[model samples]
Target: MGGNKVAIVTGGARGIGRGCALALAEKGLDIAIVDMLEPEMARTVGEITALGRVARWYVADVADHARAAVVVGQVAADFGRIDVLVNNAGRGNPKGILEITEEEFDRTIAVNLKSCFNFIQPVVPVMRAGGGGRIVSMSSLNAHSGGVTSAVSKFSYAAAKAGIIGLTRALAKELGPEIAINCVCPGVIETELGNSLTKARGPELMKGIALGRLGTPRDVAGLVAFLATVEPNFITGQDFIIDGFQWVV
Candidate 1:
């Protein structure tokens, strides 16, 4: 609120999304949380306010382009400008291709991939008008490996995550010298959902990580904060892997 820079964090209610919002707020940026979880969104807003940043939440599914456009426009107007966009909104698709229903597959693509396109379309115009901006979207280690075992999705999730990387690369080429766009494929973070996924495989997971530990949301958030706030932005079209060298690809 007090700062001039403003950032919009999708899925900013919890998990890595909340981490990214708080990190940006810590760096003195106003926050606009685009998420459907109203209660969690309020909690995240409180944290941002505690850090002395202006914060607001818009309840809507990010995959809906029309609704997403309205919120993005409102944020630009309310903050007077949009400095960064973090497309961290996504859901884990647990079923493999053959096991997943058609509806489930569609939902996964809508939330994990199409949502990026939805918000980016509206925000780009605002960023271009403002002269520059930063975009950091969340992909996953699944993008590289397709997934570890029969537990995680082998096709849908991996495809969606890979799409984010491809989308980021193309956007960087189009928005370069102005807006910097990048994606990160994080592996086994300690968020509630992440912990649940790894509960049975903690020891096995740790063995895969060269650092002997899984990543934290803060680790991923720190990179996003840097991409948004750092100057002379030469870094774009990159897919950063924050998995402690587990799925190094």
Candidate 2:
């Protein structure tokens, strides 16, 4: 469906980002991954290549504005064009209001929120030049629920994720008709980062989910693939929740 197109997925080394990368690859798009995990990122590139698609990996801290620009430019040059961008790179903060230091809070916002702007600004011109493109950022269910008492992330993470929704909404309007912008809010996806939480609350958590199972990377990936490749798409400026109908978190 996305034949000959190229997608850049941040944090595409593992977990949901990797899932999204593979799913997009399955739809016939080449992938360019940006992440700091060298070995895991290389492994993901190999997997995408095995699917008969061109894939490359770049190591960068997504929070660095200049570095993101350089990486985006490199990807555009290497791939010839940029078609899809998935802002799926982020970190979780388990600290509460008091325990968290100032540096940690700032870093959380930079990594989770500012990184979106960093990537989007550069990619927009590339997408516009090439006709148009689709952008999906990974928000969290935490944004909506404000995180459960036992949740892995606390107020700071929620704030950053919530900021992503606003970013998506504003950018959708500003970049629209040509570039489609959207974000996804996922609940408790069973990724490496979230495994500890899942293991600790496995049974108790499932009861609250309508699907009676923890979400998988594949679960979120499918929705991302659809958003990235859907034809005659009128969908944009929206946040789709892929949480298996969780009434409680």
Candidate 3:
């Protein structure tokens, strides 16, 4: 494994993932992107290279633990180390529990929640060997209030996001004193996912955004990059909300 300065960002092909990868690259870290889309992944990699940072891409569905393991190993081999892991790969599920089927729920949980563990497990040893590391996973404000702001996700999505918070808290204690891990819950981000939800919910979702507008991928990405790149944060198991004071629970 490599030393603290390399990063692996999942779902780095587009949107928030891309933004996170770029920001971290700009922060002077070599990046490895794990994503399913080759074209988009290439775009992000190209941007990283232009910024003079080493970039690698792996086309893998992180929801599959087996695939994630193999990919993580490849990343370790390619980068010669692993420092930060940004779990930015997730699916936007707008289906209510009643509207979603069993398969959909299982898949959503795997993609949004379980995938974090899938990579977290294998990457832990790599980071430990390199001394220590930082990890940041993506959550959502919807997890706090059942997505009432958008009404796009009712049960399944909310449950998965809530699960992310639980997972982050539990893991933080176990991995502490060496590795730092945290979660980010952003509200109504201005990304493809947000735009689609906006199409269904209209622009009214901006009603009470404390910042006077929806959050951007870059907005959330900045927070993720900070947690991953900035050291001695002395922070873990915390949920950092990027939403403009939508809810405080």
Candidate of highest TM-score: 2
TM-score, ranked from best to worst = 2, 1, 3
Question: On residues 62-128, what C-alpha lDDT tens digit does candidate 1 reach at each position?
Answer: 8898999999989987888998999999887778656899999888889999999999999988988
In TM-score terms, candidate 1 sits at 0.95
lDDT of 3 by residue, 120-187 (tens): 99999999989889999998887887874454556777788899999999999999878999999988
Native-referenced Cα lDDT, model 3: 0.86
lDDT of 1 at 193: 62
Best of the two (1, 2) by lDDT: 2
Q: Candidate 1: where are CA atoms >4 Å away?
A: 1-3, 148-152, 247-249
- Please give the CA lDDT of all the candidate structures: 0.87, 0.94, 0.86
What stretches of model 2 exceed 4 Å from their correct place?
Answer: 1-3
- Superior candidate under lDDT, 1 versus 3: 1
Taking all chains together, the TM-score of candidate 2 against the true structure is: 0.98
Better by lDDT, candidate 3 or 2: 2
